[model samples]
Target chain A: MSKYLLNKFLYTVDRDPELVERYREDPRGTVAWWEAERANQLLNCHTGEASTWLAFDDPEREALVAHDYVKLFELGAHPFLTLTLFIAAFERDHAEPLGFQKEYALRLQHFSLPYPDIAT
Target chain B: MAELAAVIASTHHPFYYRASTARGEDRPPFADEWVRKITAFRETLTRANPDVLVMVGSDHFHQLWLDNMPQFLIGKAPVYDANWYNEEREFGLPRMVLKGQEDLSGYLLREGLDAGFDLAFSNELRIDHSITCPIITLRPEADLPIVPVYTNIFAPPLPQPKRFVQLGRTIRELIESWPSDQRVAVIGTGHLSLELGGPRQFGPHGPDPEFDQRAVEWIANGDLEGCLSEVTLDSLHAPGNATHGFMDFMLMMGVAGEGAKADYVDTLDLFHTMEAYFTWYPSGGPGLSEERACEPRSEGKGESA
Candidate 1:
């Protein structure tokens, strides 16, 4: 019964603010922010360590981490161990639908969060 | 005599390299020693040169991840190319032969042991780095026939080490059971050490050599738990080991069989990372077996050679 810490971390942060601020750069859109943030956390988790996880980075893979993060949080499993199980479930069409991206976007626009200081 | 011959686990580090180079983005802390080790193996691979290289790596979420990410998968397509970067960005990556071995692919699923590896084999998905780099490495500008083996390492909640190894053994069983006469090679590619993003603590040149050395030693000896044990935050310099994705190497190491074989050897140190570490194994041998005890092994559909 091994559990993924990411799943717990996301579920915990999905509703709580205290945990979200640890990695969040902005407080606005905290909920939605956590989605992408969680992906970043998972993707870049191996920063200074000699890890093979981030051996190669792809912009698109960021999407996979985000999508998979939310999908796992929804299932409420500890991420690391069951993470692949959840991924397998999604691939097999045996899991829940992933539609959180838009909702997260709406939340971001609602609060103008992440301080998107984009140069337009 | 072996049936399927050999199984491989490989990925497209160069495809990722192409993307990273373009954006001028840097994935830091990938110990140079890791790559150094792999590059050395290239020569041996060239010498041993198997008939078909069984590659195990991850996809771009195109064929699977976006829609679904399987813990493990196999490809049955006859051929595939990078339609996105090649056609769109004009990268000029050659289309690779995914091998029209439907019977083998089908047998891997229908007959291979269900040692807990999930399947997501495909015939339509265009290729990605996870499927492309080996072409360049194996032949270096030559098109070599490859049987694609896809796994979801980048995506969330990847399988635990134990299960992933289980999947590797499944790969061994399936290959050992194959009846093909061609000699086979197993390849696993990805980073041995990696750090992501910018303005971060550890960069490409970051030291932290202690962790890197340990990983090299563990992988060389097929000490998975030893590798994982040392794979902690202090070594990673972050909560997660960016190179954790390289676990595929360990999985492939398991399939390659035995310990400390001189397959892929590292030479140059890229920003303190081993550019490569490669190894070669004798052909015609069967995969791992539970001789003395009933060790949890990778199962397959085999009727003996």
Candidate 2:
């Protein structure tokens, strides 16, 4: 499922102010760019030593492009990463405190126990 | 030999920094009560008069990533840079730099590994909110040298609940055996039935109040047998998706010893989660006189926020 790659994308982008804005402004473009350029680059290694086999599957790419956290959750992408990055990307849209978080919870109320496995 | 001054456990809420510091209309209604409870909680550590702090917390995908995740790690750096860009963006936590107790870190790593816990060591670790939140609440002056111990409570394939307790026990033993006269306080932070990034996120209370009630009792009473019998890696999910963080508290329970009731206990029911604080005086609370040590334990409970 390459859930690890999905998390790596969220983790890398969420830590950088420029990337957060870029992903927020253009999810499709950012997802495409990240999958092509950043996916195979080992985080702690030099660019020249980047691995060649890491790539997101079609469903994962579409979910990121769509900014669909619910789909990300269903796909077993780590929920904490998705939530933190999404909050950073979108919490500004709502004026009230915790408004976006409450809405985020309501959207996923369908999920019951044994929620999707997040193990990599 | 070093004295095990105090063993403390708490819930590390990142929102507290922003909530407590917000001014005028920006401040939430719960700020005043939270501050009061934190001030009292801070006293428990201060009264112990510790020379060093052993901070126990979990990293939230900040420095440790999935590719090379360690189950348990100790920071051996001479200094650690605290907080992160995301924490600043979300929680308004100020960036801090704290001195490290490298001698204690070295002792724990060497002894912990020899004691059968394969602990990873970091020479240049940047701690996240899990470690920093307690510092903000308990030791805002940030004067004491610290040894940061990071546990893997976030990632899956985690160590079993018993292992965390065992590690805690080993840490306590190692500290007491260290050939130094310094008094050390071990502080750890974890959650009570927390659910993040799921259907139950941001609820009025923790995702499971019944579980929180029982968990608090287990900790306050130091009922490790009761805690371990009921808690397992798989079972933690029922309380909340993120409830596994409670294992850190179990580790603290190990440090406190079996059947060792806490000397200080407090709780505050804030939105989304419960805030719990606990402290134990292994050597009868260091700075106090003999009569004061025998006095009744102090307890505080806050009204619902």
Candidate 3:
């Protein structure tokens, strides 16, 4: 359960307009590409100094590819990152203001107090 | 010594820029009232006539990340670029640049460390909506130089809630002891029982209005003992997932000092979350007249204790 890796994916992708559109259009392809090439690249370091030990596990990979925010929440991914990226990708699809956000909440009504531990 | 001009705290709602500036048909029904409340809130700072602002807010993973996050940091640069690509994309916030008071920042860092807080310093920081939103609402001119203080309310392994209050107190003490004549206002922003990216998010009101009411009372009255007694790191979760941001408000309460009732108080019960505004004048302030100083606090929706 590499919550840090999952958060890094969400954080990196959300900041980049191209990555946001790419992941929105092709989740599976983006996840596969990100895992293969970008996963181990240290954010503040040169590519040669990338850490080799960072990689998402199977469930985390599947959750990302599937665009499953609920599964990501269950997996202890940072909800803020997931929600931000999802909104960037999908908010345009909803006509009303905060329509997508309301829907996101409804979908996760099963979660109660003490939601998944998000500590990295 | 610099005069502690005014201590102000508010909820930094990013959407206010777009909502308050929206035009005919595009404007939401709530924008007019929000603007009115904000206009009144702006007057509180304007009356103080502060030269430099010590702005306190938490970084929302914009520049500070979990990989090597600082629990508390002070931006010590000569200039600060405000707003970000994501903030612009999400909140329709305009980009801004504000001058930095590096001397005050240095004073705080050197003195704050000696006071026992391992404060971090950033030379170049592009501040996000947490700092900029107040600029838009209060000092729309964005003319005053500022010192930006970032707190780790977003990330885990966060400092305890009391630590925020302690830092606020230290900030107030340090600002008073600085050997400058410039009037300084310490402004901070935080949330009240907010839930983002969770099951209770984006509701008609904040995730927990009951908690918001109690939290507002604790702040407006400067009841740090009451606030500290009940609010723990573990206990905050019951109010809302994002309620940790309320610690910034607690931090402001510490700056205001114990039993210091706010001279000005107002709240707007907006959609999704409640907006609160508070201001305390330490020395009766400069521009505030005797009659104006005695005016009743505006009870927008919530009452101040």
**Cα lDDT for residue B141, candidate 3:** 100
Candidate 3 per-residue lDDT over residues B1-305, each given as its tens digit: 99999999999999999999999999999999999999989988998899999999998999999778999999999999989888889999999999999999999999999999999999999999999999999999999999999999988988999999999999999999999999999999999998888899999999899999898888888889999999998888888898999999999999999988888888888878999999998888654656454544646433533
Q: A78, model 3: CA deviation in Å?
A: 1.0
After superposition, candidate 1 runs with Cα above 4 Å error: A1-120, B1-12, B15-40, B86-100, B198-202, B206-208, B228-241, B258-260, B283-305
DockQ of each: 0.03, 0.93, 0.88
Candidate 2 - CAPRI tier? high
Tens-digit per-residue lDDT, A1-120, candidate 1: 112333333334433335434424333344344444443343313644332222213322342245434433233333322232222223234332222222322222332112211110
TM-score for the A-chain in each candidate structure: 0.22, 0.98, 0.97
Q: Which pairs clash inside model 3?
A: none
TM-scores of all predicted structures: 0.56, 0.97, 0.98
lDDT of 3 at B64: 95
lDDT of 3: 0.92
Q: What fraction of the native interface does candidate 3 get right in terms of contacts?
A: 0.82
Model 1 Cα lDDT, one tens digit per residue, B214-278: 55555545565665555532333232234556667767766755453432334234442334454
lDDT of candidate 1 vs native?
0.46
lDDT per residue for candidate 3 within A1-120, as digits (tens), equals: 799999999999999999999999999999999998998888888778877898888999999999999999999898889999999999999999899999999999999978999889
Residue range with the least summed lDDT across 10 consecutive positions in model 1 chain B: B296-305
> Which of candidates 1 and 3 reaches a greater TM-score?
3
User: Taking the tens digit of each residue's C-alpha lDDT, what string does model 2 give over B1-305?
Assistant: 99999999999999988888899999899999999899988988889899999999999999999989999999999999999999999888999999999999999999999999999999999999999999999999999999999999998899999999999999999999999999999999999999999999899989998899889888888899999999999999999999999999999999999988887778888889999998888988545545344433323221111
